[model samples]
Target: MSLVKAGQLDYLNELFSRYSKRIYNYFLKSTLERAESDDLTQELFIRVMKYRNSYKEGHSVQFWIFQIARNMIKDHFRKMKIHKDQFNLVEVIPEREDVGDDELFEREKKLHRAMKELSDEKRELLVLSKFQGMKYEQIAKMRDTTVSNIKVQVHRTIKELKEAYFQLEEV
Candidate 1:
């Protein structure tokens, strides 16, 4: 890791190469805007570099990176308050013409809307676990919470999502 401190460009590039897609997807799922997600992803890496010295050598790099990504997302929302904006939900979700299964697409859209109705904490956990494919232990470690707590939260959040989803369906 000394290579990172010595301003080794290749080391930083390697780190970015390994994690960029994960980081971008994390932000993308939250922001739902390609350009904003890209910008936040770049900023997350920059923040990672700025705080590199603080990272313990034995720690999981993925968790550390995700923790940073989580904070960056929170700060982004706090600064812009974009969630309050009025917009067409259908338009906000980008169309994927490659998804030929109409039923699957509609289900996904309903799920997304259900996800959006959840509280921020619930939504973050859902995005990290479901969209980012993070295990509960990994999420707990990153969030500095217990695995059981994370599991419970995830369970409750899923229940909440189901209720909201059905309510929307009935309308």
Candidate 2:
């Protein structure tokens, strides 16, 4: 990143190689639209280049990149005049080897539905903390909140998810 910041355009390739899949996966998880996620991932790298000079010191590059990705998604939604709740119906479930198990598959589908029903903020937190495997401290820094606050929010979010999941089970 420093190399790219220093105007070495070739170094951008290195950054792309390192981050493209991760960024794409982030979009894929959030959007669940393969083509849209691909486009967003490409656009994110373009924005990084366009805003290369704005990259500051002492911040995690991953966090900075993700913040930009978040902004891009928000802008996209705004431009389309779509409410997040209507569009956020897709959630990615990890593929299981036992694909023949009807019960497990049904449960996974229910969980995905419950995840989609969560508020966008809670879903984003879960994506960053759980799926992305980022630490609470890192998420707090990215979100401009205290670690304790992030922890509390994550706990509450999990509880809500559990309740939602159970309600689905009952139905």
Candidate 3:
């Protein structure tokens, strides 16, 4: 990061090589669209280079990069003018290796539906924290909030998700 910020253009390639997969996976999880994810991932690195001068010392590069990613996703949705209802919500469902297990497949489907019922904010929080395995502190840094606030939000979001899941189960 420092190297990139210092006008070392070569460092951008190294950084891209190291973080491209992680960034692509994050977008893939969020959008569930491979082509869009790939495009956004490439755009992110471009923005990284374009705005390299904005990089500051003492900041976590992971958080900084993902903050850009989150913004890019928001921009994508805004440009597409797609409502949450129009999103491919089922794409969030993980593919099952045991495709023959009807029960498990049904459960996964139900979970995906329940997750789609969540507010975008709550859903993104869960995706970053639970799915991406980011620490609360790191998430807080990305959001410019305190860790305790993030923890509370994560707890509340999980509780709401469980309620949604059970409601779907009952149906």
- Candidate of highest TM-score: 1
TM-score of 3: 0.74
Encode model 3's per-residue lDDT on 1-171: one tens digit a residue.
998898889988899888897788777666655677879999999999999888789887877899999999878767545664554543545567644587988887776678777766677788899878999988897888999999999999999989999998677
RMSD of each: 2.9, 3.3, 3.5
lDDT tens readout by residue for model 2, 103-144: 888787787788777765677678778878889988888778
- Write the number of the candidate with greater TM-score, choosing between 1 and 2: 1
lDDT of the structure predicted as candidate 2: 0.80
Per-residue CA lDDT of model 1 for 1-171, tens digit only, reads 457766675798889999998788777767555777878998988987898887777777888888888888788767546655742223234476755678878887787788778766677788899888899989888788999999999998889999999998999
Global lDDT of each model?
0.79, 0.80, 0.81
Q: Per-residue lDDT for 62 in model 3?
A: 78
Which residue pairs in model 3 clash with each other? none
Candidate with maximal lDDT? 3
Descending-lDDT candidate ranking: 3, 2, 1
